[model samples]
Each structure stands twice: as C-alpha cells, then as structure tokens.
Target: MASFLALLPRSLTTFLYAVAALLRFYGNIDTTPISKIPLTILQWSFITFILGTAALLANLGLEWNAGNRSRNREIEERNRADQERQRAVSRARIQNRFFLLQTRHQLTPSPETRTALADFLSFLQEYGE
Candidate 1:
C-alpha cells in the first residue's frame, strides 16, 4: 500500500502529461477554429484524471489492507491449531502415565522421567494457553 501510494503522484503526473500531448495534437489540426473550443474540456479532463487516479489509489490501499488482515487471520488460526495439537498430545501422555501409576499402585516415578514429564507438561501449558 505504501509503495502504491508513493507511485500515485508519479502516475498522475504521467497521465496529465499524456492528456496534454493529446490535446496539443488536436489543437495543432487546421480545423475551423481551435480558440472556439471551450477551454473547460481540457480543465475538466485534468480534473477527471486526477479524481480517477485518487480512486484507483484508494482501491489499491483497501485491497492491500484486506489482504494483510486475511493473512494475519490465517496465521492466528494456524497457531491456534498447533497449540491445540500440542495440548492433545500432552494430555494423552499425562493420562497414560497416570494409568501406569495406578496399575502399579505407586506414587513415585523415576527421577529423570518425572523431571522430563514435568518439563514437557510445563511447556505445553505455556504455549497452549
């Protein structure tokens, strides 16, 4: 959007120059009377060109903003989905560990395994929340 806005002035200038060249061409013709043609036509053409260019620039800005918003929405959705997956995996591991502990009727886990599971659960909570 910024880039297009930057180019807008240049584009308008070029369009005005082209219009002037066309008018000059018509003016050069040996028609009945060049002076009689309303100068309003040239003035109106320049005004119309400027208005049209402004509209075009506004449209480009709107589209660019919408596209960026859509991309951000997509990224947010992807992150949410990833977090959900991680939570599901962590829940499953915790349940499995609990089940094994129940079957063995033991409250104690091997130190290394306990530390690893605790760390994994902490990571899941940090990201999934």
Candidate 2:
C-alpha cells in the first residue's frame, strides 16, 4: 500500500490518504486477505509511520491557525488602545480650549469674548456627554 501510494502523484496523495483513513476506520483490515491479525513489529511500525505523518501535519496546521488568530487579536487590541488614546487627547484639547476662552472673557469683560466663551461652554457640555 505504501509503495502504491508512493507511485501516485503528490496531488492525489491527500485523497489517497483520506481513502486510507476511511478504510482503516470501516473496512476492517483484519478481515482482508492482505492483513495478518498478528502483525509483525515491522508492519506495525510502517502503519504507525503512515498515520503519524498525517497526525503531525494536522497538528502543525492547528498550531499555525491558532498563531494567526492570536496575532490578529493582539493587533485589534492595540488598535483599540490607540483609538482610546486619541479620544482622550481630543477631550483634553477641548477642555483646554474651554479654559482658555473662559480666562480671556474674565480678563477682558468684552461682549465678543463673552459670546465665544458661552459658545465654547455649550460645545464642551455637548461633547463631554
């Protein structure tokens, strides 16, 4: 069986492996003429090698998938943190503008500055909410 699989194209190897797996599960190799119930140590080793190769590839694929998922999650977390920082900085800028306008109005006592302060206070109230 191994020799037959080796003779086949590499592209067909995966399909053959699938077929081999189905046969292993349901075909009952013990009943087949090719299979001996009391398998020799060499025969057992060959079977183990065949199945182990498939298992190793499956394990590697699962690990690779897990790595990608973790990396993507980390990137998303970093992006969220950056956006939060940007929002905090924006709020600080708004607060600074409000304070500066209020101080200017207090010192000058002018109509324009008073109106500007009023408008900024309203903006601050709306944005802070």
Candidate 3:
C-alpha cells in the first residue's frame, strides 16, 4: 500500500497532462469537415503507436545487455572449473610418480634411482598433494 501511494503523485500528474494535451490537440481541429469520434481515435492511435515503439526499444536494449552480462559470467565460471580440473590432474600426477618410485626402489635399487626418488619425494611434499 505504501509503495502504491508513492506512485500516486506522478501518475496523477501524467494523467492530467495527457488530458490537457488531448484537449489542446483537438481544439484547433475543424470538426465541421471530419467527425469528432474518428479524429479522436486517430490521435489516440498515434500516441499509442509512439509509446509502443519506445517500450519495444527499451525492452530490446535490456535483453541485449542481459545476454552480454550472462555470457561474461558463463565464461568466467568455465575458466574457474577448468582451473580446478587442472589442479586435480597435477595432484594425481604427483601421487602416481610417488607410487612408481616406490615400486622401482623395491626392485632394482640403483643409486641414481635413489637420488631421483629423493628429488621426487621433495617435489611431492611441496606440491600440496
């Protein structure tokens, strides 16, 4: 109710102005040549056509803006999801490397492989895995 009342002043002002405009438009017309009802109808139709065009353009602008903003947000979300997937792959790679090093150490036991295992272990610890 409060919100409805807030619009009352502007609505009343617009209605009174429209009425005054219509009276002034019809006043100078020589109704002796044309009937009053048809002349009134034509003016009303013209006003409504102009208003409709304005509303259509306004809605089109709103829709275009919404689509552009939505596309940007969608791209951002796709990039964030792609980053998360890459992080998961990195963690898995670290785990797989640790597993392979352990299995090889149990088999051949080469010193070079031992050094590689130490380096790999350090990498794994720093990898946030």
Candidate 4:
C-alpha cells in the first residue's frame, strides 16, 4: 500500500502525458502560450476562501492543543497538592497518637506503652528518611 501511494504521483503524471499525446494526435494542439490566463473572480474568491479556512482551522487546532496542555498541567498540580495534603494529615495523626501514648505512659508507667512508643519512633525514623 505504501509503495503504491509513493508511485501514485508518477503514475498520474504518466497517465496525463498519455492523454495529452492522444489529444495532440487527433488535432493541431498549440503548445505555445500566447499570454498568461487570468483567473476569474469566482476562481480567485474560491482560492482565497480555501486558504483562509485552512489557516483558521490550523489556528484553532493550535489553540486547542495549547489549552489541553495547560489544563493537563493544572490537573497534575492539583493531584500533587492533594497527595501532599494527605501525607501531612497522616503525619499529624501519627504524631497526635504518639503524643497521647507518651502522656498515658507518663501518668501510669507500663511495658506495653513503652514498647508501642519505641515502635512508633522507629516507624517515624524510617518514614522520615
């Protein structure tokens, strides 16, 4: 399919030449151009309309892509901020739990409370790193 598409232009050109030759054989086909043919108003208007439409579509596509990029960046930033807030909340909860355990241990000393405090400190050390 790719090779066929690549050869399409050459094939069309050869076909046009064959057609021109056949036409020339049937009549006295003048090859010389007497003057440059000026385009009619409608033809010029059609060309200008096509060019303007193409430019407008191209500009719209560019703007759409730019808007999508900015929107994606904003969404990513929002996601990152949400994740940070969650982490901060988790850290605060852990600290509050640790403080509560420490206060209980200070009021009434217990082996279980000491072990739990030690475990919490170890977890904080590992997580902070």
Off by over 4 Å in 4: 1-38, 110-129
lDDT winner between 1 and 3, please give it: 1
Candidate of highest lDDT: 1
Predicted structure 2, TM vs. truth? 0.51
lDDT of 2 by residue, 79-115 (tens): 9999999999999999999999978667697888788
For residue 47, model 2's alpha carbon misses the true position, in angstroms, by: 3.8
Compare candidates 1 and 3 on TM-score and give the better one: 1
Model 1 C-alpha lDDT per residue in residues 1-129, reported as the tens digit of each score: 988876765676567667755654665453343366655545545555666577567667766887999999999999999999999999999999999977565345678667877888899999978
Q: List the residue pairs that clash in candidate 3.
A: none
Model 2 lDDT-worst window of ten: 5-14
Q: 70-97 in candidate 3: lDDT tens per residue?
A: 9999999999999999999999999999
Could you report the Cα RMSD, in angstroms, for every candidate shown?
Answer: 13.0, 11.4, 10.6, 12.4
TM-score of each: 0.52, 0.51, 0.45, 0.53
Clashing pairs in 1: none
lDDT of 4 by residue, 4-49 (tens): 7545544554554454455445334443432475654344444445
Q: In terms of TM-score, which candidate is strongest?
A: 4
lDDT of 3: 0.68
Better of 1 and 4 by lDDT: 1
CA lDDT scores, all candidates in order: 0.71, 0.68, 0.68, 0.66
